[model samples]
Target: MTDRTLYIVVCGAPLASRVGDGVRQARDRGWSPYVIPTDAALPWLEDQDLGGAPVITGNRKLGESRRTPKADAVVVAPLTFNSLNAWANGNATTYPLTTLCAALGSRTPTVAVPFAKHDLAAHPAWLASLAVLRYAGVAVVDPHDGSAVSLEPITSGTGDAVTQAFEWDWALDRL
Candidate 1:
């Protein structure tokens, strides 16, 4: 197995399941998974073992965490629209956003799975932010597509959507 560690960052409750799935996928493929969550996700993170991976909180430590030597890639699952906007605008106001910014700045391969309502998804600001992220070399996985399966409703966490986020192998291909 390679020494590379994949960092999984969850920004909210719903994303914890996605991160868990990602970790399982990574482990099944013989890769190491490191879990991290923002303050907003603390409640959920606390409930999970995350396969014994270290979980860091707060923005002050995020930059340092991103620079961890074994890191190979970073996955921001269930990335909220607010966090996405913050990251796109280079406004690292929170830990997850700060870690993402640090990862990008350090040339770490990062992928974001954005889960939002159709209206918010279609907003011009969101589109602009996505464009900025793409131009900056950050891959934004639009969970709206049928490719990534969703564990909850796409509209309000009550309706189901296809879960088709890129698998670990596909993600590695982008790197």
Candidate 2:
């Protein structure tokens, strides 16, 4: 356990299946990571090895205390288009979204890895949302190469390959 807390926010995308990689990398870097997954991400996490990190899902009970410590940094991997748009629009409808919104509002150091295919990435909102997040100081890394300079959309039918090729160090390095 370490004093630094890293919030790993996962979404429902092929890359989500590798969240364990991120958790392990975070811990190796001296960050006590907490996985916060969107409901849709549950399936992908079914067989993941989180290395004993806690996964926080859904809303907390009224009388329950906060489950995790304050985040020192946040990494949103496999940032699906839906969650990305919702987060950029400040929609805190779900637990994951609420956590993202709060992290953004608090100006927490954040890194987001968007995993949208070419067609979806072509939408006007896609680039706009990236712009919005960048303007807010979030490090937007390209899932393919961890390039913070440019983010290329994943080609159709290449999601699996892209996901497999992604490295957690790409996002963690930025932090």
Candidate 3:
């Protein structure tokens, strides 16, 4: 069996440079890092030099992929607000969501870093969805403190505050 312990899934049009950095960070830490980009994210991945890491398209059977063998944990970085709502409601409309559902179903531990603006992020529905996800055993990292403006260190960067939810060691410990 392979020695991969972490699966990093990316969705949306995130910066290639930032993604490359995150992937490098995961590898430097000794975790076999595999980057899976949803269909929407494929074009972006194709444009970047991923340093030979496999980029699995979301349309395929993700659960059966070689990357899923013994994933100690799954992290969804820069999770879209829509994706967060879908996952919270058990809606697997996309490959990433489906894979997330499968991982959670198999009790493989999952974490999400939702990216959205302050107003959208604070919506009651969003909060409710987060509650449901947390209740159902999915760790939803809150990137904002009470102020709701500044982001926690882990979540701070380009794109959105949601990236904070996928901080490597922080999410790993939860798993």
lDDT of each: 0.66, 0.94, 0.62
lDDT of 1 by residue, 1-175 (tens): 6477877778764645555666777777666777767777777666554666667665444345444454678888767778888888888777677778888788788877776666676777887887787788877664544233231225665324333343444444344
What is the TM-score of each predicted model, taking all chains together?
0.77, 0.98, 0.72
Tens-place lDDT digits, model 2, residues 31-69: 999999999999999998999999999999999999999
For residues 1-175, could you state the per-residue lDDT of candidate 3 as single tens digits?
Answer: 2365767777774532245656666677666767776666666566666666666664756466554456777877656667778777778887677777777777777776655665666667777877786677777553333122233322335444333323445444444
List the candidate 2 regions with Cα displacement exceeding 4 Å: none
Best-fitting candidate, measured by TM-score?
Answer: 2
The TM-score of candidate 3 is 0.72
Q: Residue 112's C-alpha lDDT in candidate 2? A: 99
Provide the lowest-lDDT 10-residue window in model 2: 1-10
lDDT of predicted model 3: 0.62
Give candidate 3 misplaced runs (Cα > 4 Å).
13-17, 61-68, 142-175
TM-score-wise, the better of 1 and 3 is 1
TM-score computed on alpha carbons, candidate 2: 0.98
Candidates 1 and 3, the one with greater lDDT: 1
Overall local distance difference test of candidate 2: 0.94
